[model samples]
Target: MDGTIINSIASAERIWGDWARRQGLDVEKFMPTMHGARGIDTIRNLNLPGVDPAAESALIEKAEIADVDGVVPISGAIDFLASLPPERWAIVTSSPIALAKARLAAAGIPFPRFIVTAEDVKVGKPNPQCYILGAERLGVSPSECLVFEDVPAGIKAGEAAGADIMVITATHGHPVETPHSTISNYDGLHAHISDDGKLSVVRG
Candidate 1:
């Protein structure tokens, strides 16, 4: 999801930025840190004085679901995803279920049949738990899966889970640290599945 299948940056920044201002934190310093993290975890990490992490996290979830304006699919994401077999793919996102579905719907991306959201696992990204669970739910080994991620935490999770990783540069459009591959977006890439069930990616 987010920055991969859907471009929810506008809404995400708006909501999180507002939260930061309300909490008297530096929005510039705080914004990037929030990506690829669960809301609850993010709040706890902030460690703001006089704030309840759990309550704030719940509020953020509500805000994210309600602020779906400007959410849209990343370029070529819809077509590229449609070309793949559903059973071979799953979205392992740090977003909660409601926000994930709302973003997908707003972006016109079909909600994935196999999705692991923040609520689905005890620990979030960079822990490998969610990604591992995703592979398990997809009925595949970790080595058999390819994860597309935008942020460092998600990339680390995919790596820790023993899956190949493709870092999407849509968020910052900069080189990442040691990803298996990097793509600007889903544009100009082709996915092919052999009769023997081998998947191949070709750059067009």
Candidate 2:
């Protein structure tokens, strides 16, 4: 729900950039690769020679907490979510539980009834574990769930899980490729959720 439901990418980038700079690392090269990765996995993939793992963990933790206050809900997200039947939706995120909760609470977003966090999944986005788990937790088959994602990795995960995915260009700054459909904003998302529980973009 982070980048899609709440516009937290700028805040996330700023926090990671500051942390990377303090560690004498190249934020530009590192931040992009870390975008949709699990928190600890992002640090591990950095493979910074001579860097202390414990210190990196501490830095990431602090930065994520500090950035929470800067998160804002995407325009129309609240109304779109409100219009849906909660039982049919869920949040599958790469964020660890603590950081996810912080960002959601900061953005004043209601906690999703079914949530699958990075901590709960063995594999992260681009692997589909989170999305699959979310579908399971919601008592729905993957094919019946409609995933809303802002990044290619998240979109890939949803697709891999057999769900029809919808792309929201929030964090990626470009369109994500998804087989089902895409929307620039959540303004028409409610209409897209049909009576049969399938989602489709409303044509003009």
Could you give the C-alpha RMSD of every candidate to the true structure, in order shown?
A: 1.3, 2.6
Runs of candidate 2 with Cα error greater than 4 angstroms are: 52-55, 175-180, 191-204
lDDT of 2 at 157: 87
**CA shift at 122, candidate 1, in angstroms?**
0.6
Q: Please provide, for model 2 over 59-154, each residue's C-alpha lDDT reduced to its tens digit, 9 standing for 90 to 100.
A: 786778777756898877888887767776788888877888989899888998888887798767789888878889988799987788877677
Q: Candidate 1 residues 1-204, lDDT tens each?
A: 888778889999999999999888989999989988898888988777889988998999999999999999888898898888888889988898888888899999988889999889988888999999999999989989888988888888988999998888877745666636788888877689889989877767
How many angstroms is residue 50 displaced in model 2 relative to the true structure, after the best TM-score fit?
3.9
**Clashing residue pairs, backbone N/CA/C < 3 A, model 1:** none
Worst 10 residues of 1 by lDDT: 171-180
Off by over 4 Å in 1: 173-179
Per-candidate TM-score against the hidden true structure? 0.95, 0.86
